[model samples]
Target: MLEHLKKEQINPSIIEEIKKYRQKYADTADTSQTSLRYLYYGKEIWEAAVHALLCGENLLLAGSKATGKNVLAENLARAFRRPCYNLSFHINMDASSMIGNDTFRNGEVVFRPGPIYQSAVDGGFCILDEINMARNEALAVLHSVLDFRRTIHIPGYDQIPVHPATRFIATMNYGYAGTRELNEALASRFVILQMPSITQDNLTRLLLREFPGIKKQFAEQFSGLFSDIEKKCESGELTEKVLDLRGLLDALRLIQNGLSPYPALDMGLTNKTFDAYEQTLIRDIITTRISKKTESTTIFS
Candidate 1:
């Protein structure tokens, strides 16, 4: 997996650090089971993440939706050849949910470890997905673990020391609805990387990478369509729901599978917004891009 990243011309020192970590620890988890493959870390964010991780600094990827923060986190884990634990932070996740909780197992209370606890003990890379959604109070437990101290203090248990190789790559979107600002103290713990929106060329390459059978012309069209929707969202003409790369890809898949582009595009773009007026605006954008004869056409046929 790391060999494929050579084309990106990553820093030699970062490569050596990853190799050293691979040699130092036994990687217990296999990331090959997922459908998510062929990640392309263009230039900037890739170097920042690699350098930060090599420096033993925790990583915090801040960006809006569809900037590939989670994908980069997964790629880093695979590149470093380490087990990864994905812990999704929502409004309800508390400190105990992150560390561990005492549960009765056949009449005796036993500590059942959470993602953070296990990652701390076993030295795995834990991806804290949507870290901002977590209440700042709930995430305070992570302070010691992320800092130089590298320890997790459980209220009922002993202060567990983190393994040398343990790392947390957290991702959060600012200004998104239902998201909160991360406390300064927590934000200060990691090397924060502001991820940029992917370029059109990179977006096309990503589509081709994920769906090799997709025609280049259609890939360009899909990329353009996504960019258009994103612009509309940014302009407030449409809601953020339609600005989705995954949805566009899924709609392309549907088209390839014989659905009309209009319906397929609807499934992907227009249907995302619940407001009737917003859906009408979204539909107008789609119709403006895809014509009547074009609607019937699939990728190849």
Candidate 2:
């Protein structure tokens, strides 16, 4: 995969740096962190990320939904051969939850490491998903860790220096319903990269890669369907919840499993949202873009 990236014109020195880190963490690389499907990153985004890693900068992937932020984060971890800890930020996230907490074990309280703590100690790549969802107070523990000092101060335990290779990749979907603006302090700690949604050509390539047997005509229609829904969502005609690439892929999987296209797509796209009005609008979009005839040839077979 790194070789493929090299062919894309990513900096050689940056690739060498990743090679070094991958070797250092060779024994600890988590297979799960590696993506099963090839993650398609735009050339510019790929170059920016590689340089940021060389600088030992934490990454903040700021973008709209379906921009492949999480996918890229996982792909980076794999390319660098690091153990990955996927952490989801929530409204109730707290410092203790991220660092460590006192736990009763063997009749004594012991400090159990959280994802952040373990990643810091083991030189793993920690993926903080939806970084802006957690309250600022809850994210305070990340300050020192993400800064130039690269150390996290645990209240009960003394400051622990993060392994030099440990990196944090955070993602944020700004302007989404529940997302908030990232705090400037945290933003400053990261190399913020604004990600663009995958383009039509890339999306078409992704679809074909995942579903190789899909018919050309139907593939084009499916791609246009997603584009249409994305536009509707962006224009406020549909909710973002209905706009999901995973849903799209899963629906295609359902069709492969012998379900017809309409119902299969419904399972992936329409049923995700419970609102009747929203469902109707989603169905309308699906109806317009996808029809029974699109399933004439079984792509799965």
Candidate 3:
């Protein structure tokens, strides 16, 4: 991962800091997940995130759907070789659920650590996914943990200081359903990064990386198809649900398995929304880039 960072042109000093951090926390930092499934394609984003983590600042990644926010978070954790704990925020999430709660042990009550608590003590990376989905009041618990205080205060027990290698990466999708504006007090706790939409070049790089055998021409078409869907979403012609990178990858996989491009795309992208009208629009977009008779063998090496 450090070598990959070097190839991406990340700051050499930042890479060195990451290397030192890994060695410093070798005993506590979990290295079980050695590598990431997807490498985040943007060098600027990688540099910014690595610098932020090295500075010991919590990060809030604010962006639209399919912008690779979560992907970048996982990539950062893997780059630093830290054990990652993913905590998805929802309406029902609360401080107790995040930090930990008193529970019954073999004979008596005990405090069972949650993801945040475990990450704090073990020098792990805690990914707060879709952070805005929870109420502002529910998220207030993170203020001290994220800020310079760097401590988790359990009401009845002693405060646990966060390990130096522990980092929090939170993601929020703009205007997503059931999400509210994060309060200024809570938002002020971390440095925010406004994530940009995936560019055509990065999209192509992602496709080629994910499917090495896929033809470059087919990869370009798929990238074009995604861009078209994103444009429709921007124009309010379709919801963001159809602007699916994972769906496109799944479609490519199906094509690899001998499914025709159209049907594969229909199942992967068009079928994501049940609205007949929206499905028709998505199908039209797919047809513009992927031909009906395009064969699987032609798409792959």
lDDT of 1 by residue, 60-148 (tens): 99987878899899888888777789999999999888988999999999999999999888888999999989888888889999998
* Top of the candidates by TM-score: 3
Candidate 2: deviation at residue 221, Å? 2.7
C-alpha root-mean-square deviation, each candidate: 2.7, 3.1, 2.1
List the global CA lDDT of all models.
0.82, 0.83, 0.88
Model 3: CA > 4 A from native: 235-239, 273-281
Off by over 4 Å in 2: 3-14, 23-38, 232-241, 270-291
List model 2 lDDT by residue over 193-263, tens digit each.
Answer: 99887766667778877888887666777888888888988899888888888898889887876778888
* TM-score preference between candidates 1 and 3, better one: 3
Off by over 4 Å in 1: 27-40, 232-239, 274-291, 295-297
Task: For candidate 1, give the lDDT.
Answer: 0.82
The better-scoring model by lDDT among 1 and 2 is 2
